[model samples]
Target chain A: MEGSDKFFVVVIVMSIIFTGLGTYLFLIDRKLSRIEKKLKEFRGSKNNDK
Target chain B: MIKSMWWKFLGLALVLYSIIAGLLIDVPALPVIHQTIRNLFYHVSMWFAMFVMLGTSLVYSIRYLSGFRMRDDLMASGAVYTGIFFGLMGLMTGMIWAKFTWGDFWTNDPQLNGAAVSMMAYLAYAVLRGSIDEVAMRARISAVYNIFAFMLLVIFLGVLPRLADSSLHPGKGGNTSTMEGLDMTMRMVFYPAALGWILIACWLLQLHTRRRALIQGIH
Candidate 1:
């Protein structure tokens, strides 16, 4: 590959990596939010019992 | 502590700047490496980030040893997992850069071998964790093992490479320091790129530990 073409390839690889990382972070954030909500509900029910 | 968003945004902004400036900024022209030097920001930064993540793990492991808190153990493992993720990125990006510059996908260079060894050591930690069933025992044993593994990491990746007689990778016995070729212009983008990735790694570690905490209810 020409020099410019190789640079482009590197750029594409970086972009793909960035996308994968962003997607993973977003999914994990969503999962944690769900878990926090559930924990809050559980605590609220326990408080009601008291 | 992870609730703050400012640092996360700062990490994102710095990374964006590095990506842009790294690509567009004029780099020193040298034989063999040429423009591939631009990879300094992306490829090398991954290793930097990995180092910080593992360092964080080391701190948490020591904390676990002192207090024997299961939560500290969990956070330690979380940092390890995150460090491994960044290490994988570093490995892949290094492979790509190697193919283009060194004309090989993999080489027998000391630094490369050291990195591979360090990664396997951490992976073994994961496997070690899987073997135990009891909670406290798992935490205690893994915390001790984590410290050992980190020491191995430092020896392999940092010490052995410098002790080697010769290596294609920089910072070896004969080679100049890793930052030697990075002229002032390149340093502008490089430092922030590294710091940005380190912050991003911390953010990922926070998310990882938060998920682990919620599932295990240790926190």
Candidate 2:
């Protein structure tokens, strides 16, 4: 590829990587909070039954 | 009390020095806007903090594995949190610098990819900690996983990217260390800026760790 074309290609790749990372973290944070809530509820129920 | 006061004074001095150096330093004529070089103070300092915190976390991880102590786990967690903070700051400052100098907000250069990988590995450390219920089990598993994550960070941030290709980043590939180009006046300021930023990061780590310990003790 030409020099300018190569630079642009690299730039596109970087932008995608950054945006994808931010999105992935946002999704994971949401999912983890849900799982934590369920786990807290389950543990509470177990303690009450004892 | 005396020690704390000493550190406070030292930190103050460092901050003043960094600010002065950043304002006074001269740059040769380049295509990029001049003031953007100021980001170097914040960007490099945060990376130093990240590396230091990650190293500390790795040490605590090993301690937790061998001793099964809750304190070790707490220390590891504190380091990871601090590491995350510095990593984010580094990423932000780097992105801002890139935007100004490169004329884009982001790009897929080898160095940038390596930095992204390092951040992701640190994120995984937090996820791993949350996965386990019991403290002992969590410590054991997180500690083991941390070793892997730390290695990945070393490889991704340190070795692999540098080996890949040329980067616009200074002090990489054939680029000379910009530090040497700086006159004595710049060095006088630059050293203090580095010192000040690292001191603040260390203070944050210590404060968080101490607070966690107090909470644990009270419970």
Q: Indicate which candidate wins on lDDT.
A: 1
Output DockQ, candidate 2.
Answer: 0.02
Per-candidate chain B TM: 0.94, 0.88
The native-contact fractions of the candidates, in order shown, are: 0.22, 0.00
Where's the lowest-lDDT run of ten residues in candidate 1 chain B? Answer: B1-10
lDDT (Cα, tens digit) per residue for candidate 2, span B1-49: 4444466447555765565445445644456757666666657777777
Off by over 4 Å in 1: A1-38, B1-3, B174-176
Angstrom error at residue B102, model 1: 1.3
Runs of candidate 2 exceeding 4 Å displacement: A1-50, B174-182
lDDT of each: 0.84, 0.71
Candidate 2 is graded, for docking, as incorrect
